[model samples]
Target: MTIQSLGVGSGLALDDLVTQLLSAEREPKEKRLNDKEERIEAEISALGQIKSKLSDFKETVDEMRRDSDINGREPTITHPSEDKDIFTAEASNSALRGSYEIAVTELASGSRIETADAAYTESTDQVLTDGLGSTTMTFKINNTGDSFTVSVTQNMTLAQLREAINNNENNFGVNANIIDTGTATGGAKLVFTSDVTGAGNDLVIVNDGDRAELDSLTTTDSTETATNLSPVKSATNAKATIDGIPVESETNEFENTIQNVSFEATSVSPLDTDGITRVTSTLEIGYDRDGLDKKIRDFVDNYNKIISDIQSLTRYGESDLEEDGALAGDSMLRGISNGLASIVGSSVDSSSLGGLFALGVELNSDGKLEIPTTDFGLGTGDERLEAALEDNFDEIAKLFTDEDQGIAVRLYEMANEYTSYSGLITLRERAAKDDKDQIADDRERFELRMVSYEQILRDRYLNLDQTVARLNQTGSALLAALG
Candidate 1:
């Protein structure tokens, strides 16, 4: 009398009936949850895609809003001859447009000093001849305490002494070498060169120990005066003449000599026909028209890309055969697209040249930016762009970089409103995620309800099953009594 299975005791298809009832109860609610989850997921995905694109657009506009990208200067040099590279020059945005005649007379040189002839008979000769243990010698730059010492042992030869001096860790730019004059009169001479390049900065060696033989290597006395070594070359400054005016620098690079212009003297200019007069090269500073033009074109292209993405995201299907966009009919997306167009088409008051139209950038009928090749009233797009770059180059920077009214500045701020961490798009995405989580909780509750409903249906069928079984037994008993 206990129903082990739904149809076992009743002789009816109760299992199939129970299955149909559960289906009727669960299908509608489950379908609603599934549809909602799919919609929320699509919306979250679309929001993420748009947020990424907007961030990229923001980065591009941020760079365009910088003055360095808009106002740049280009330096052009014309050497006196194609074969000779006399000098190279560079100019900054602050440099004025002008041409100058530059003549490099002399290149800066460091000091060189060599030992006297017959200083040492051979490379194997010991440095400390009079002393037994060792002697230390100090090498210094003239008039400064900057010096390094080399310890010469009794067994240290002229060659080894040169190596020791050259290999010392504290050695400050002094290089040592031996020049064999091939005779005793100019025997193996130890030469020293200093990279210290000013006119008064000279290299000198001093004998720190009381070894008379060490004096052979000393270039200065205890008072740091030049006394022994012969001066091969004196430290000299780089000399140049700009517009027939003289200028000199301790190093080869001359900075700001010509108001915001810096030039490096590579080599002396070629001599003219007279062999005494040095030829001059031309250095010209002008606005970087090409660079500015490219930046303007990039801005137009990038803006158009954003517009295209927005159009795709917010567009509805044209027919029943096509599926609608994920963000179709979204007011927020429409507002973003409209806001972008408004800012781009608006005028900026900070620049005298006005907004993007002055630079030949225009919004087309399709809500995208373009630099048309067609000719209109003032000039063609290329012509207007070229004129702007040539005449109002600095104004172009103001139009895009000014804090109050720059187009790029305003656009960036607008994009930031939607793409920032606590922005509208992020908040919307988080809300969609919350809804999906709620759907999961609903599904769990729905499963629990199905379990309870199944138990109730089984319990109600059990009573009818017992009554039918008892009635069948009584009818059989009455038939037997009549027989």
Candidate 2:
């Protein structure tokens, strides 16, 4: 650590200067090595952050797998408490010839006439009994009962009036029909019928004339809602069964949750219901199946990234010997790699529909896992995808979460138990904070020690320089004195 001071011309302490300079210069190198280590730790720390998010997202994907309708599609869903099993085909064979008393309520207000012809009308049998003009609408009362007429001003169309008659088949117990043409008599006439002999789904229409009743279009009253009234066609004909659920709808619009698959029928029904008519509807879902897919993709992408990063850590420094370094021998990464390799090729059990596709899954040349299906034209399928999904979803989910089969298991283990859903990111976050803290601390100590070493070296070198310079000066003085 000594420094020759002759180079200072003997005017200063050269040894001290050199020692200080040397110590200072050498110290940063060691300090820099420590800094480099901190940087590597930080890099690892950041990767861990992304890893934690992927684990949470993985659990979400697993849960949705059990609930998805399409293989990898999302849904739009709103759980509103409307009514359940509200369909009351309480309608039967007698539905065509039912009657009951009616009390109409006008939504708007004004001076009104007790429209004999304009009063309560019906569509049932209208087209059948009357000709095309009968299509104007008519209703015959099967049972007048004791029901009185509530006067109103609004004119009821054959369609509107027909709906009014059948609105509460179960509640009011009435069905209405109109004759297609004028009765053998004259004037348009509306008819009301009772599906049940007693009076279920039947009604009497009261106008401003002598009250009349026509159970079988007998034209009991001359002052009915309409006279010579035509008949409107019968009620709507709707019947369908999407998968196995029967539906009765006027149009193609219905929502049902059956067989654990959310159905959004639209203009189409997959199965025929023989006689039961259903509405055609378009099925739609929000943020469910497709959401889960995005979630799964996130998991896979993060997984691959972590694996690649770990790979680099093991064989760093461009040396053959580095190939056997820390990451290269990491058992955790090896386990994860093997786990991924297995899931990519696992097939399904196909015993259900006569082993429709004996081959469970196929890998396309594009590296996509193609699920085998029947029929292939999308009627459920040539082979039913629905059937396969029903039979195999549980097994598919196992590959993502089970200790022996799931990616999460190996991924969590690779994370050194730092990633988990049981406890929300507590361990992981601390690991990150502690890492950054260690880097800062090591950098600080390294900087301080480097400063000290430099000072010591500088002092030694300066002292040597001073000593050498003094000897030269003394030799010069001796020569002068001898002269």
Candidate 1 residue-wise lDDT at 123: 88
Report the CA-based lDDT of candidate 1 relative to the real structure: 0.86
Q: Which stretches of candidate 2 lie over 4 Å from their true place?
A: 1-6, 11-39, 42-46, 49-53, 56-60, 63-65, 68-327, 339-418, 421-436
Candidate topping TM-score: 1
Q: Per-residue lDDT tens digits of candidate 2, residues 89-128?
A: 2221111222211111111111111223433333332323
Question: TM-scores for all candidates?
Answer: 0.81, 0.38
How displaced is residue 267 in candidate 2, in Å? 15
* Per-residue alpha-carbon lDDT of candidate 1 for residues 402-436, written as tens digits (9 for 90 to 100): 99888888999999999999999999999999998
- Model 1 TM-score (2 dp): 0.81
lDDT (0 to 1) per candidate? 0.86, 0.40
Considering summed lDDT, which 10 consecutive residues are worst modelled in model 1?
A: 221-230
